[model samples]
Target: MWVADYLSLLITCQAMSQSDMEGVEQCFLDISVDQVLHYDGVPAVEPWATMYIDAIHDKRFGDAIWARYQIFGDVVDGLIDDGRLTVLESIEEDAVGYKKNAPEAFDEAVAFYKSVTNSADGHPEVIEIIMRIDKEDVSNRYFPEGG
Candidate 1:
């Protein structure tokens, strides 16, 4: 079921002729931050969050690291305000891990996230995770780019 949704995301992107995979951004926005966390299989399924950031051209994999960054500020706020995490926890503790594909993309996303929101000043925990590269413990899926 999850794989189908993941594939659907890809097919939707392809059908829309999104070469750079802009569909990821749109899809994440469509799915909503709350929905993303509701899925227990997100860690096992949403493995592409950063799985293929390096070879942006074609590497058999893609994820919405960019959009995640866009919405992470809110995610952080919600989690922290709810007392789920402390002000010292990192993104790695959020239970969601990107495949660490393109660390730079994560960086750029963090920059964008911070620029638009007060997340940086609101909570250090949010800042710690959103800005983290988190290349240490992440799964990298190698799905065929054109497959």
Candidate 2:
């Protein structure tokens, strides 16, 4: 799945040693800007984006995170360009620390979810994706291990 693909990239990014600048650059190259920009995966995969952003802020990834951040921006811009407006808006809103306003954020997410599900653009595959994501055990859902 796309989430697994993303997580694999992130895990590879995080595991790179400081001396592996060449490998780091290659990793950056491997993460296609087009793919990130066109990402149409379910909302459950959103945390992987956060994980990438968090890696940027972390000291462990060193300066490679800056390049990752640039790619992330490209992805965001792509989302905007592709008319994934709600996804972009949700990302912006979620950045405000959802834990501090869990109830409100969750309600908003649910409302947003309903809107998406009910939209004319909605499809059976999208609903299936949502149902698959929703059915995962909470532990695996939230803290999935990279394979």
Candidate 3:
């Protein structure tokens, strides 16, 4: 699963008052730190905006994931254009500072998340938002950890 997707799961569980955060955290996920260390004001996820707005119009309780979407939904949508999707292969070369040095930590985090989701059979649909966000390496700092 992607970083934003993982975060959304945590936020969703937190908002729902579910204990999934423990499962997520105990899995040793690390996208949160990678997001903090790599932000550069790029855009974010588009599908999450659509899903969040749709949820807002519905009668559901305030999902922590949705609340996070509320915070960054616009930015997420802006990342996409009418006819294309941005694809981030990985962190850029000459990453300048912290991003240059954080690969091992980030990879460790990603591995844990993979293990957790694999153990679960598969990641849930809610995590797709984070996947979308992470795929672009867009600015995902708005969705905080432990939210």
Count clashing pairs, candidate 1.
4
* Poorest 10 consecutive residues by lDDT, candidate 2: 138-147
RMSD (CA, angstroms), candidate 2: 17.9
Measured on C-alpha atoms, candidate 1 has an lDDT of 0.37
Best by lDDT: 1
**1 against 3, candidate with superior lDDT:** 1
Steric overlap count per candidate: 4, 0, 2
Model 1: lowest-lDDT 10 consecutive positions: 54-63
Q: Clashes in model 2: which pairs?
A: none
lDDT of 2 at 144: 18
Candidate 2 Cα errors over 4 Å, as ranges: 1-107, 115-119, 122-124, 141-147
lDDT of 2: 0.37
Q: TM-score ranking from best to worst?
A: 1, 3, 2
lDDT of each: 0.37, 0.37, 0.32
Residue 13, model 1, lDDT:
53
Superposed by TM-score, candidate 2 places the C-alpha of residue 81 at a distance from the truth, in angstroms, of 19
